[model samples]
Target chain A: MAEEVILLDFWPSPFGMRARIALREKGVDFDLREEDLLGNKSPLLLETNPVHEKIPVLIHKGKAVCESLVIVQYIDETWGHECPLLPSDPYERSRARFWADYVDKIFPVGRAAWLSTGETQEAAKEEYIQGFKTLEGELGDKAYFGGERFGYVDVSLIPLYNSFYALEKLANCSVAEECPKLVQWAERCMQRESVAKSLPDPHKVYDFLLVLKKKLQPQ
Target chain B: MAEEVILLDFWPSPFGMRARIALREKGVDFDLREEDLLGNKSPLLLETNPVHEKIPVLIHKGKAVCESLVIVQYIDETWGHECPLLPSDPYERSRARFWADYVDKIFPVGRAAWLSTGETQEAAKEEYIQGFKTLEGELGDKAYFGGERFGYVDVSLIPLYNSFYALEKLANCSVAEECPKLVQWAERCMQRESVAKSLPDPHKVYDFLLVLKKKLQPQ
Candidate 1:
């Protein structure tokens, strides 16, 4: 079996970061191909993920696996018994998967809320707040979403949490204040060497959002 | 381990039906708790799925798993080596999961186009058309999304296909004409005994849409 793995990614994409973190955590060495979102994508990315033509396409042994969550699962399964992302227990694995799915569904919509204005933005904010609150409540007193250890759920959730401060600033609402437990959880996740090292700076995200808001606003 | 497994679901929800179909396919005979989405939700539903409070909660030996895709995976994992939803091959499993995730993300948004009116509806229609075209292009000449066998991807996609006629009728557009191959693929799926038995009447779905549209319309 060939061990050649290449990751096509952009720096700010949380989805791409997930694959990077997973690879790093597993102590697997792979080639990282940085993509320019503004310019034409690499031939490798296009060929690898013909359907979506999106980033975070993990080419393992020349086979492309698209979608961050799906790629994460593939990595876990392929590298099973070597720093497992998923739990060995069937029920526990299901629970971990459930949280990852929830994060995938809600995070994009929540992030979009910060980019819009007026009624649409207001509605998005309400939904976003509700989602964060639910996450906070679910966390309760757990050290991580996967109970004590930092597993798949924590990896999935923590990436999105990287944008919370920036999103709060852009929306003019404090997600941290509203969902304290989730905020605390985010902070706790940052303490992990894997998370701390993998995540990009929060201020750069804020700057990016400011530019995005300017570009999106009516002249 | 108990032989009994219960599914909390609503008939109209494609998500719920995914669980029902998976259960039936697995030959797992259990209790079906039909939830009334418009009226009062059961305490069990709330207790079981505290985060989402959504249907398609599969309770096995008192533990509940939410999210349709997650539940499907759970069912497959729990069941002994019989009709497996996921392929044993890691690469094949990744492909199956990719298409399933694609369908899960796009189907509802496409359905929303049918349920809207005026400019909002037009925007949704454009989005739906693009998604449909992509889906069709992806299918090419494959018998199922997972090639020959009607595996997890086929099961995930068929429910959305069942609603296509209803959606086209509601939106006053011919999806079949626009994406002939996809329509044919869907019809092929319907020919299967498992799918034919599991799905509701297509006309009934259109009738249900009329009621939904009326309720959703501004007074």
Candidate 2:
């Protein structure tokens, strides 16, 4: 039986981008049905991810897999083995999972940096810099997070590159200056066709975020 | 060499209970170093999990595994596959992961129900009921979340059995009434030695939560 693989995706979500990159890296032929996230979410998305009712859901073989990292793991597990996203060793796989989780959990820092003002924004940028520096320490002369391979952590963190632009413009900070190796790593990741194609343009994302900020604040 | 397995655990944490349960389920003899999480976290816990500075950290043969579900997966993978926590099939494994993710992500709903008061608490309790009813729907008539197997989702959620008492007391509600099957599932899970021995007393947890609430609110 032919596999029916579909992704209920949204273009600007960094979480959504991870799924896109992972699927592309595995060379999976998938239909990306872009979601109308702001105004109206599709019924299929609501049905597939009834728990979260969020995007980047992987519907494969009539089963819905929600959560971007979970979707990435699902894609990695169910699809092409030639390019494995996660490590085969148990400990190494755990490490990959940890770093991906770190990326998932660290979003509020980045959001505060991009969306807030004055003292709160300043503190968040400092924390964001520290967060990236920690990632830099983890990267630490390795070609990628799992050492030389483009694996799970790379797929997880690379999607944040577009967000870096927003932080740079809005927060008036440079991740390049703050965490040199992480920026270098992002550059390396961007060279990959999968990452390059999956991520949205930074300017567009920034504009949308500005509009979102106004909507959120309602001033 | 004998496996040097040590858990950096805290008594009040459902997250910590997950690692404890998973390790016991694998029958891996190990040390449980209870952390003074509210006061001074051990330097080893600090060193092992520098980013989160949290428990439970499952240090297996010098490698530190943070995050509860990830630690559970590590234990399931590294030790005995005799009673596999996750399913063998990638699709089923994804489903297991999805439901486990569901449990991990639903902590805030449960927290709000326990911690807040009046309208906010009432709303959170409603949300909590809806969330568990969703779980009950997914659980169906299955002996566990993954059919008859006491698997990943079961392990992920069963630790929360202790928290049920806190909600019942503080929130003035009953999950046993709203989510009867889920409560029954919790009872079923408690029958296992892994779950029974690992989970703390519900009353103790409730007391700690009350103390925590006072500390948090400064009232």
Best-performing candidate as measured by lDDT:
2
Local accuracy of candidate 1 as per-residue lDDT tens digits, B87-180: 9988889988998888877886777788777898888877777777887887889987777766787778778876777777788656677888
TM-score per model over all chains: 0.92, 0.96
Model 2, runs deviating above 4 Å: none
Q: Report how closely model 1 matches the true complex, as a DockQ value.
A: 0.77
Off by over 4 Å in 1: A118-123
**lDDT score, candidate 2, position A53:** 89
Model 2 chain A poorest 10 in a row by lDDT: A166-175
| Predicted complexes: DockQ each | 0.77, 0.79
- Top candidate (TM-score): 2
lDDT against the true structure, each candidate? 0.82, 0.88
Query: In candidate 1, how many clashes are counted?
Result: 0
